[model samples]
Target chain A: MTYTFHWEVPLQNLPLFLWGALATLEISGIAVLLGLLIATCGALARLSKHRLLRGAATVYVEVIRNTPFLVQLFYVYFGLVVVGINLEAFSVAILTLTINCGAYCTEIIRAGIQSIHRGQTEAGLSLGMTQWQVFRYVILMPTLRVVWPPLASQFIATMLGSSVVSQISAEELTYAGMFLESRTFRTFEIFFAIAILYFVMARLFSFLFSLTGQKVFREAWGQL
Target chain B: MRRHGRSWGWIAVLGIVLALAWTASASAAESTLDQVLKRGKLLVGIGLGAPPFGMYDADKKPTGYDVDLAKLIAEELKVEIEWVDTTSVNRIPYLLTNKVDLVIATFGNTPERAKQVAFTKPYSSWNLVLLGWKKDRNIKSYKDLKGKTVAVTRGTTQDIAITKLAPEAKIVRYEDDPVAMLAFEQKKADVMPTAEVLALKKVKENKDMEIKGLVSRSWAAIGVRRGDPDWLQWLNTFMDWHGGQGKFAELFEKWNGVQMPVALPRW
Candidate 1:
């Protein structure tokens, strides 16, 4: 109650916070892109006819989903050095984010793939489409339509969870907040500003995802 | 339009309620000294993460230099001690928010922090030094840290100092002392600026690392909320009394395994 609010602190450090926001977006953007690629491949592998491929994807999803993100981040940043794989903190952050979110995305995509009836594949084959063509035309598109909402949520979660990368000094929004808070000691004001910034960024991300979904599934956009 | 007006009315009501609550709390608030005496407890904040200064022992009890110092102060005040675990970044905020009556968590006295909290006379002192591998003989001064990744605990004195002194250096800040030290140990950083005692401990563990350069001599003091002149004066008197009696020196030697300085700067 004796505390005096320093509202000017966040305003004065607005540039740094913006820079941090940019870094947060950069990492989250790259991680989401790479995670999508990994998830698509992992989902396909999980449903592959070959035993080894399915087992590998299953193990990856199980292991990553079971472990905490912080421990995985520490391992990627610190533990990987022992094996002679030295990467910068930013790279380690992106790598860990991609790997961690890839697991969740893989499960999500897998569920979407499974939701497709076997009759759909049979219908595609009866129309004389190749296996790859059937997968591309008959399965993947509808699966994406079915899963876009949850997928968008997961992507947002990944973006928000990117805040944890500040632990490794990745210079993201949360790190900028910590840096400013350290110097100014205006904890409430700084964090209040940071929370608003993060909320704005997350909303921006959600908007972008919705736009992309609308464009990619133009006819089904309304249903989505 | 009706919904908007209703929301505006709600906002007004909420603001008035908050104002009443603030005034109620403000009126209920008393000076830290009076509050402690009246409550029969001294709420002391200490960083349990920093070792030798504050850390859990083998038995999982909080036993360190800062914890011991807090105990001494509580004993002197004839009150039961209650500890609030703090981190480097939260120390000032904790004091400001009245989460703890005082912080004894190896808090470095600096003008910037002094704006937010009152620091007592020095209870312990150490030089902030650049620590790196002994083989890295090229780093002798602040300029030599250019392009090198220096690890630091976020919000610690060394973090501020290194960032200010060697702005070009790639400073990687961890959340706390132990993690920063871990980053340094794991070779995630090329160098680290830390307290001399902590640097010495690291060097003892790994003979390859040594103190490369002294940045500044830092004094750790008890941090109380600002505007509590009476509380500050009482704590300063307690410091002077114990300091004259060599209680601080005794504790310093016991914890740090080095003789205390013959004279510490007083303000």
Candidate 2:
């Protein structure tokens, strides 16, 4: 109750916090790119003519989406070590984030692909386009436009969820906050600053996604 | 609509901050001891994560050295005991925020920590050591810890000590003792720095680990909010009185299955 706010503690440790923020962005950025790749493959697999590919994709998505992310992280980081599969905390963090984000993004992407009318695919084929070209030009482009908002939200969620990686000492923004809080015992001040940093990061991600959407879609942006 | 929602979010945050300030100011007038006496209940924080010192028993009830000590303190105050489970990192914040009147959570007394929370005279004592697999004789001293992954509970005495002493050791800090110990057990880390008693317990359960190096002999004490001289003094006197009666030693033996290693000094 008689506590004094040490605003200087966080201010003095700005460099460390910045380094941690960079780590957060680095991990999340890598995860987002890898996750999107996995989601694309997974979406294609789920819609594939091969039953085996569809079944495997379904299992992967269901297994990841059903279980808690923390448990999955622990399994990769801690549980795997018991069987001689030791990995660094940062590597485990990125690995888990990629898989977790991949699972959710797969569902979103699959829904987007499914939303394309069968007539559009038939129309592309009738126009003398190859299968890959039609899939890319007709299905993929419109799918991106349709699912961009949800994918952006999922990407932001993954970035926010990266804070839990600090539990394994991954040295991200939340880890930096914890390190400062441990030293200064300024819990509220440290976490409050961290929350603001996360907010800024999320906003930045949203802005980047919109710019990307507009650039990629071009004239199709508003028309879609 | 977006601007309207944004303004409402700011207003909500302001409201919460003002509420916190109001409660902090209101509680500032009375010392923790006065509050406990007036409320007829002693709110004590204990870490259930650390075994022997603080843990659950066969019945899943909280029963450990720290818990027993807290019970004794509450009895001395003639008040009902209410336990607030805390972890290594949150112990000090719990005291600072008035969530608990005192924390007896295997909190090692350190000069750095003393700045945040007042510590009574030591009620218990233990040595911290770098524990690793018996097969890894390469880790014999602090210098040997170079490039090795050392797991520790975040914000604990051993975490700070190892970070300072063996700066080159890759420290992977978990949120609590159990998680860090689990990481060590799983071999996620090459070594773990923790209480000697905890290390010995682990070594007994699995024949692989042994003490690699000693970090420091630490004294555990009750933590109270800083600036509460009245509460701090009362706790010091309570520890001295009960400690002189060998009650703490008896509880230590009962919970830890060993005699007290170091005689707690009375100032």
Candidate 3:
């Protein structure tokens, strides 16, 4: 049946939908931020000379990579209670997302760290630069160039994955659609609007990432 | 050359990491239900969109006939009701997977469904009712549906009714009931067929629609997972007492403005 484009939702509950959208963004953004921090640490650990640090990093990468994100999220969100590590729902959402995204970012960033070319590291070492200086000066900038796109994409994925947080009542965008459908009994309309909101958010994120990449990697040979 | 070597190493690292995670889950072999109930609330699986049966309110508190009704059942079970909102496509899988203890969502009883789960005797009955513009006086009966398009919820009895009674008529399948009601309001179709009480409620709530036919009644029952005879029997008896007494009838009239169908036998 044809329906009019409703100018106003009957209950005047547009704010719920908007609030849900913002929550989705916040969760995804927080996850991506913390995930980046974790990925750096894990990537560094993998490069460590000590077997324990390297082995631990290796185990983390293998386990997180193979499992489904849904299963992992459930484990982190629900399993914490078994160990008496009680966390709020929002905290779980952010934590699960950070862990899930971290493993992937570790792989991508490790490649960037490794791609600094032996010549550059040798050049830094010959100039009496410490290992730390070589890593920061030679490795960090080069790796950032190669990994920026995937990092942006990972953040975008975090945005979508935040929907799973609805299972734990994080009250994100999909949760808003759920709330609206319940109240309005306008299930299809509510979901349709939600899908549109997600689409717009994803597009906006991609646009921002593209702009940021241009600024960060403008000197890369591919651009020239 | 070194760049290619590192990329290949990363791939190997990725492979090993995944295998370890899989091993842990394989060994755990725990149930999702035990985990949920231990948290002290029964996580109910329901299609929060289907109204009068399930769904929530503007305040984000779940409120509907199904929500209220389920709250009663939860109170009796002495467990807090924690809703796990789902879609129509997800309900059965949710129950069989033990994501919910029971569903008070308005699932019509069918012989096919009996294979998958146990059902309490119907606490409510719903029928396909045709709705039209309030001023449209002539199109009040199912017989009037010939040669005209009708709007129905996809995959429901309304779709079946349209296909069976007026095969020549075009049927527009909306995703849910309220959408169909909106379609009827917009004159998108001459009539919309839905659960009678829901159609009546929408007609009263909206400025434009009217309910025309009571059509046919289908049994709406609470379902439990199959093989749980003890739970099943308890639910059947609970429904019988609460709904059989005048209390159920009084609530039905007070909130919904209709009586339980008399022909349906008690559990």
Candidate 3 lDDT tens digits, B20-54: 54334323233333443466677777667776666
> Against the hidden true structure, what lDDT does model 3 obtain?
0.70
User: Candidate 3 — which residues are off by over 4 angstroms?
Assistant: A1-12, A218-224, B1-267
Task: Point out the worst 10-residue segment of candidate 3 chain A by lDDT.
Answer: A1-10
Ranking of candidates on TM-score, top first: 2, 1, 3
The TM-scores, one per candidate, come to: 0.93, 0.93, 0.49
DockQ of 1: 0.49
* lDDT of each residue in A1-224, candidate 2, tens digit only: 45666778888899988999999999999999999999999999999999999999999999999998888987888878767888888999999999999999999999999999999999989989999988788898899889999999999999999999988778899998998888778887788778778888998999999999988888664443
CA-RMSD of model 1: 3.0
Over B60-140, each residue of candidate 2 has an lDDT whose tens digit, in order, gives 888888998998888899999888999989988788777788899998889989888888998888888888998987778
Residues B146-201 of candidate 1 have per-residue lDDT tens digits of 89999999889998888989988998888888788888888889898888888888
Candidate 3: Cα lDDT at B200: 69
For model 3, the docking class works out as: incorrect
